[model samples]
Target: MTFEDTWKPKIDAYRAKLDEEVGPYKALVEGIDYSSENFNAVEALDTLLTEKDREITNSTAKQLVAKQRDGTLTAVEIYNAFAKRGAIAHIFTNCAMELFFQEGLERAKELDKYREDHNGELVGPFHGLPISLKELMKYGGKVTTAGFVCYLDNYISNSPREESVSIQILRKLGAVFYMRTAQPQSVMHLDTDNAITGRTSNPFNRKISPGGSSGGESAAVAMGSSVFGIGSDIGGSIRVPAAFCGLYGIRPTTKRVSGLGSLSGGAGQESIFSSQGPLTRTIDDLEYYMVNYINMGKPWEYDPNTIPLEWKTGVSLPETVTYGILLTDTLVEPSDAIKRGLAYVQDKLRDYKGKKVDVKVITIDHDLMKEAFKQTLQIYGTSKPVHDKLFAISNEPLLPLTKFFLGFANPEENDILTNNNIKEQFKYYMYYLFKDQGIDFLISPTNPNVGEVPKNLTHWNYSSMFNLIDFPNIIFRTGLTFDPKVDVKGPTNVTDYNANDYVNAPINLQLTALRFEDEKLVEGVKLLDKALELA
Candidate 1:
């Protein structure tokens, strides 16, 4: 049989599974045409939600939790609202790889029953929250396809004990998982596309990408189908998608949160470690999830790789906050929209009415960052042998993006040691810059562009730099959107990002801190959000 004959059946089966899981909810958006040009799925989807659904889905996780605690909203009611919106989001954007609506609702019902039986005591901090997960996270008895067609039948454990450690913690905290989001093939591409579930579109503008490998999560969160979503990041996975979707997300210091049970390539590779965090609509909600997930969950006790550090509370930024704003990585310059967004932020910081804040234009060490970028590509390729085996198992054809990614893999692991040594040197250089300049935090572009056409995202230098140096970074929207009429192209030699193609895409910026300064980083972003009046 031909390649399509072999793989097409698996794709069909995977999609069939999603439909079967979605069940009756499919009728809500059955007749809508999703092929229209430049469709605003996020806006269109909002109208379909009932007033109650809108209220539930629009509220942040913290708000929903507060209502649940006060007995104003039951777990089942919240789940029902999100379930309807999430189903519509999936139909519109293809954001969901798997659906567990029945299971999630049942769990929500149980939480409500428990509350009724116990006089309104919440089961956990995140009681009754509907969370979307990236496809790789194990959810018990579900297939954990890490975007590879070959692993379509690899079902996870059927017991709660076998769920991903992070999932287990979230479950204990009363999170209901109803949807699994999409990722790119090989789980390496910065754009979301794969053979099984296809590409996830940007809800803001269907013409462009939602960003990946957490693209589905970003799309879901942006569509208001989810209050927030969980995503993993190694090289711009979480931050890029969050930026592309105009949401907030973070990549915490490695091992601060457990990644156990999240399957992806590079099982034991430590040259560049992956970290997982939330994608939320508000910075306060982002902090809420982190503080509760780490402080209350205590993931280190469950996942051996997690650090023993508790999520710090009462952490505050320095008296006179110093922000080193990086205009470009000197590798790929940011687009006009991003430049405008940076200028807006700089102006806001300069005009802050609060405590002392200083904004200084800083230049990055291009040679050093370029070398580190190359090292990251090589390190990523070391998992080629393992990925090759997965592809071979089912004779699955490589997607275009996966082929492009594998092309950068080293022939062997010989250079891994050298790659790691260079990483250490780069980290030291960055740390010195922080100390020497007394920089409290660093601000930079989240991507070269606001959003790229699907399967066309390039230049990850802005986001991947943090992954290389193992720093914690948070991505937040600037309350600005790309206006092609105003965000005109510059000299054209500096960037290849065409603003005309990214109309209505939100422009976001990155806030980064030294390694293990996650608490302080969150605090700093909170302050920056206040300065900029981000709601």
Candidate 2:
């Protein structure tokens, strides 16, 4: 059989399954115009849901768990609310790869029964919380395509090869997974558009990207479809989506969260490994997920690569903390919206100086950043042959972003050695930079621009630099949105890259701390998030 002949049936079967899962919620999404170029799904459809439904769906994960534990809400009610809203989000943005609402409802019923039997005691920290997963993560007896069409028919065995380590941990903590979100083909693009599920658009502005690899999760959470969701990032996958969609997300240092059994494009490439973390609307939820997943999940016991590190809570920062501000990467200047957001934070910090925090501008080595970006491309390019073989299985035409990534030739051994040397040298450079400067953390734009139009995305210097250096980073919304009149383009002599006018797009700032200092990073982010009133 030809590749098309072999893959057509598999693709059709998956679509049929998705239809079947969403069939029950057809009435909920009825009368919704899915083809509108620009519309706010949250404002339009939120009123369609009952106040109770809205309350449960919009509550943070911690709040939901508290309600469930206190007998004020049931897991089944929470699951049904999110499931219906998630179905609507799928219709609007094509963000869901798989929906198992029936399965989720059944699990919720079990949890409610357990809570009743145990005298209103909760099962775990995440009890009764509706959490979504990126399609790349393994779900027992389910298929994980990771946006690769060839893997549509590949399913995990029900018995022994069931869940990924991260899923297993979340399951044990009483989290309910009703949906698997969409991602881009090859799972390497900054935007989430794939042959199987199409593209996931921003909830705020459908014409622009939701941010990828984790775009679907961001969109779903932003629209209150799920309280929070899991997103894996090697190069700003989680943070970019969260920033674009006006949410909160973190990319922890590698191996802090177990990746065992999770499907990835560069599975064995250790040059820059991906780390999984939560993407939520609230910073507290981000903290809750990280703390519980590490301390309660005991990830090191599940994945050998994970370090045996305890999750430290209540980490006290110094009364006077220092922050280094990075205005530009020198490769590309941030848009007006991003510049305004940075200035807003700088002014806030300056006002708070001597009372709480200290702020200063720190100059970065543009040459070193350029080298790091090149090295990142080389590391990512190593997976080209693997991706080629996967696509060849079904003879699927490469997606635009996939083709763009593969254009970079793989580096030779000597080049790889040289890149490694550069990485090590840059790592120490940052280490001493922080120490000599007495900077607790560094702040910069999550992306050069707020958000981009689909298929026009490029420039990962703002985020990829940290990925190359293996530092933990968090993206927090600055409570600012793009305005055409306010964010007009300035004169530029540079010709290589041109900034796009992102309308109504959210602006976010990224905060980075030293390697393996994930806890400190989270604490620092909470402080900044509060100071900025970004709750």
| Model 1: per-residue Cα lDDT at residue 461 | 74
The per-model lDDT (C-alpha) reads: 0.85, 0.83
**Candidate 1, run of 10 with poorest lDDT:** 490-499
Steric clash count of candidate 1: 1
TM-score of 1: 0.96
Winning candidate number (lDDT): 1
Error of 2 at 444 (Å): 0.8
The C-alpha RMSD of each candidate to the native structure, in angstroms, is: 2.0, 2.2
Q: Give the poorly placed runs of model 1, Cα more than 4 Å off.
A: 1-6, 30-32, 159-161, 410-414, 490-498
Tell me the lDDT of model 1 at 183. Answer: 90
lDDT per residue for candidate 1 within 430-471, as digits (tens), equals: 999898988989999988878777545656778987898899
